[model samples]
Target: MILVLEKASAWWDYAWLTFKNPSSSFVEITGYYIDRYASVGAFLRIAPNSSGTLGVQTHLLQKGQQYSVYVTIKGTQALEGPFKVQLPAAESEGT
Candidate 1:
């Protein structure tokens, strides 16, 4: 995830998660949650050899939040994650 590239003047902090499927088959990411809340604009489908991304609003941090990513592939029992949700240390602490 990308969180280090933030500026103090920014109103919202950002983080990113990206993935590529190496197989020859198309896949759908049917679920995505961050800190137990569903992420906005999370992907529903990802073409083969293509990538998918999950975004985080790090500006919304609360006492150094705990978060994770989860994915369920379509038409299969394949499960891809519970990946750690990491953000760069804040540029500056704010109230």
Candidate 2:
């Protein structure tokens, strides 16, 4: 199993997280962000040689603050990340 968190794009309140299951068995993923103590139920069923994406919401996130993101495979101790993500300051209205 492979997990990756894509660089956050235009969305100020969420980030795109991708998971890949390269083995010949199906896998499920559950995730959470440490800073907010919020759990994101990705619970994806990724088949062999397949991948999926989940949108991790940052609604509780603050600009310039770093958050630790983690994902774990269901029914196993396999875990990934403390993936650090920092949100850029929101653009001000009316320059």
Candidate 3:
């Protein structure tokens, strides 16, 4: 499986990054950030040519900015899951 975190800014960033899987099972991914709004990208698994993730990232989010994530299984197939994203909370008065 391939995982992608995108930061959608008009500025420069890594267009694509590839990962090689040394195992043969499903992978658990966490804390992924897609930071851009318009940029398009995907995670590609070459061995079985199965499962990928595609999304856009953005730097700014408004209240109710609407964030959604979907996964693609076997390239052409899509599966939806329980994905949620929240704005980073402000620092408290005390450390």
TM-score of each: 0.54, 0.69, 0.32
Worst lDDT 10-window in candidate 1: 1-10
* Tens-digit per-residue lDDT, 8-62, candidate 2: 3325777566666667777777655455486667666777777777677776677
- Report, for all candidates in order, the number of backbone clashes: 0, 0, 15
lDDT for every model? 0.53, 0.65, 0.36
lDDT of 2 at 8: 38
Best candidate per TM-score, number? 2
What clash pairs does model 1 have? none
lDDT, candidate 3, 26-47, per-residue tens? 5433223443334234443434
Q: Runs in model 3 with CA error above 4 Å?
A: 1-23, 26-39, 44-56, 63-66, 89-95
Q: Give me the overall lDDT of model 2.
A: 0.65
Candidate 1 backbone clash number = 0
For every candidate, C-alpha RMSD to the true structure in Å: 7.0, 3.4, 9.4
Q: Which regions of candidate 1 are displaced past 4 Å?
A: 1-14, 35-41, 56-66, 89-95
Q: 2 or 3, which is superior by TM-score?
A: 2
